[model samples]
Target chain A: MGDYALEVTNLTKKFSDFTLDDISFKLPKGYIMGFVGRNGAGKTTTINLITSLYHKDAGEVRIDGNRAEDDKVLYKESIGYIGDESYFHEAFKIKDIVSIQKDFYPTFREAQYMQYIEQWELPTDKKIGEFSKGMKVKLMFAGVLARDTRILLLDEATSGLDPITRDEVLVMLQKYIEDGERSVLFSTHILEDLEKIADYVFFIEKGGEVFCDYKDQIMEAYRMVKGGTDELTSELEKEIIGLQKSSVGFQGIVSREVGDTIGDKFLVEQPAINDIIVAFQKNMGGNHTWVQ
Target chain B: MKIVISNHSELPIYAQVKEQIKEQIMTGVILEGTKLPSIRQLAKDLKISVITITRAYSELESEGYIATMQGKGSVVLGRDNDLLREQYLRRIEEALETAIETARFLKLSNEELIDMLGNLIDDE
Candidate 1:
């Protein structure tokens, strides 16, 4: 097995209008990497490429050292994908889907699947179409966890779920990676969900990778500075990014070094993941440096 | 030990974990030789990434707050209360320096600052 559970190098996919350009990141073993972006930001496209659902125009996708193009069956087997929408037929009952999965995946565990079914309190006899959205998500999670998969790729899996159900799913993910052998790459627009579980964050913007680093390092690199309009100097303006002004005051984000240079002149506070994303998007024209 | 995390806070999650655990140890709520949860166990319990828990534990270990044994989990180590007290005092001093700088910027006199500090103590 490779040191990284999932690694994409210069993954490029081109559509008529949008291009996923040179996207690259690594999800190390036993870590959850949060893939964050705005809607239609090529997140789903990248995930599709990783799963081999969509052919790449260029670049390599690797799962445990097996290229997606080189070993299609093994690469697919090594990854479990849960997308926003259900892939199973609505007419199939839970038991029917279980049997199908058992036939398809060599490592599918019937006992483990049943255990998760019991834990989730899902009805085996009920058709998938009759299940609620949250229940469907739970069922999908149960199926994914029951398999001996090394890497999980989730695409907006928790978007519409209630807060409590979302928290439960996050806890389940935490438990799944306890053995230090599995890894997760989850793409979502919800920064709050990632705040609780992500070790590394890979942020995509306008079809390009803007930031990729550990969550702690990202938190330490940017500072949200707020001050009166009178405090806005030309030098400071050059240093600040995504500067916004209102009738009363102004606010912007600056590098930690720049914030320190300004000293007590402006109020420097830690920027949340949401704030950082917003500011970074606003300052999209600036050079994008990949933070380690 | 009971620990709380605030996403809105300025501190990073690992820093918050380290501080809360250190506080518990210093206050004697968690005694010396107490076995802390394994990194994986704590991460699962907290619904966070194991890497984050690992970072916190590493920081705690470097500070001599905990010791990890091979094939076993980490345990709390005896702390020097005097050293801890000194650390806290230094933090307070740093905060006070900022406060003094702000006060000077606001054109507050030394006597007025003293009076304000006195009033704060009395109210508490």
Candidate 2:
């Protein structure tokens, strides 16, 4: 039990091909936490572990101040999870899906569900099997929006959506956070969405936690430094966490304070989320070293 | 209005966004007095940071292409004759700066560069 809606301590999960090591992070109550990474970066693994779809090898997971493992039903009740793929019956109508989920979640709001269904313009009687990909995503989002779960875990929910649809989805999710009792753990390869909505961000690489912090802290604290390779000293290099070099020039992530200390010899640019992750991955030998 | 962005461009994203709006203004696509989208709407539309769009609008207003008021959103301020004249002078100054830099690189005298410019302008 903690102040966080979702908390993990030194979480580790292993598989034949990959392992999520020492993954520790938290989502503050009622805030949106964007779980960000590149492809196959163990984002889904973390979501799976949180939902108890996969058991962890080590560490702890708690949802809404309750141990996720100790109270399966209560944990499930508190969490509404949407993974990379869904298993809705194709032949089922949108109404049918709502009817089914209503039985599972006591707080499921039929009035709210109908309101979102109409607001999102979802096909009520139409079979979900016939819906477009964007429509399916909208349907999934609509379902989740109507539920009263305190914790939401969404994996790559807007990855392939068109700009307009993506915007709509983003607006929907942002509006979902109006109820301060709710929180979101949204994992996505689409970094732009996170840039807009996430209050905090967790960056994972190669099944390991790279960095996690408030979105503003990340934007303010790290900088991308560009300079001639010849001007780069070993001492300067030591201060950088992720150094990327090429024949033309070099770019790396350095602390904002450290970058200022380097003086006018280098160009210090704001580091984007993607740049930070790539630099960290490159520094880790194109693989990642767990920081447990 | 249509706007194009080059992936190869090194300009910061906010600058690109401002340039696009300015282009629309310069080209008469976004009419004077027309209400522009909200910062949130534009950010949502363009898939960029809200702060970026806010900065763009702020610059546009400072340059006199648009003005923003709370709740009413941003609106295109009709091109003032004086402002247009200032814009032209600004463009010429920018061209002069570039020409001066190139002349310095080539070690060309100011007179020589003026002669070259005369010929180029005559050719145009």
Best by lDDT: 1
Q: Tell me how far the alpha carbon of residue B105 in candidate 2 is from the true structure, in angstroms, after superposition.
A: 33
User: Model 1, B17-113: lDDT tens per residue?
Assistant: 9999988997889998999999989988887767788999998887777888976999998766454556667778998899899999999999999
Q: Which residue pairs show collisions in model 2?
A: none
Q: Model 2 segments beyond 4 Å from truth? A: A228-249, A286-292, B1-124
lDDT (tens digit, per residue) of candidate 1 on A1-292: 7788888999998899999999988888888999998899889999999999999989998888789778788888888888887877899998798788888899999898899889888888889888888888888898888888889899999998999999988988888778878899999888888877899999998789888998878878888999999879988888777889998999998888888877678788888777888788788887434434
lDDT for model 1: 0.86
DockQ of each: 0.58, 0.07
Per-residue CA lDDT of candidate 2, range A136-183, in tens?
877776677677777888888778789898778777665555444567
**i-RMS, each model, one decimal:** 1.4, 4.9
lDDT of 2 at A116: 75
Q: Write the per-residue lDDT of candidate 2 for residues B2-59, one digit (tens) a residue.
A: 5455433546566888999898898898898999987756655665545556678899
Report per-prediction Cα RMSD to one decimal.
5.6, 8.8
Docking quality class, candidate 1: medium
